[model samples]
Target: MTTVAARKALWKIPEAMELLSISRTVIYEQIRAGRLRTVKCGRTRLVPDGAIAEYVALLEREAGR
Candidate 1:
């Protein structure tokens, strides 16, 4: 049987930055501005895949306006 690669449900801050092609400061700024959503697990922050998608959609909507 062939197997497909599994997608990540959660991403770390650095990973999200890389995925979004943004800098660390910008990522944190987005989170602080409520443009991006993140969850705190212990001392680590995690971004859900859905949040990233939502952020992109938000940008697209803004661009379309």
Candidate 2:
């Protein structure tokens, strides 16, 4: 059976830009630099659902204890 849910999901560049509150250029730069990972479906690209959480962990590590 199918179900309905209000789940969050991987966003396209524009939605991601809104979530992260950054510019399109900056987001594109990160994707180009491989700092952020993405998935491709046909001609569309998307960041994974876990990407932001992983990125935050990396940031924490970089900060050092």
RMSD of each: 1.2, 4.1
lDDT of 2 by residue, 12-65 (tens): 888888877789998889888887788998999988868866766776898996
Clashing residue pairs in candidate 2 are none
**Steric clashes per prediction:** 0, 0
lDDT of 1 by residue, 1-65 (tens): 99999989999999999999999999999999999999989999999999999999999999999
Model 2 CA deviation exceeding 4 Å by range = 1-5, 63-65
| Poorest stretch of ten by lDDT in candidate 2 | 50-59
* TM-score of every model versus the real structure: 0.91, 0.73
Compute the lDDT for candidate 1.
0.97
Evaluated with lDDT, which candidate comes out highest?
A: 1
Q: Where does candidate 1 have its weakest 10-residue lDDT segment? A: 5-14
Local lDDT at 20 for model 2: 76
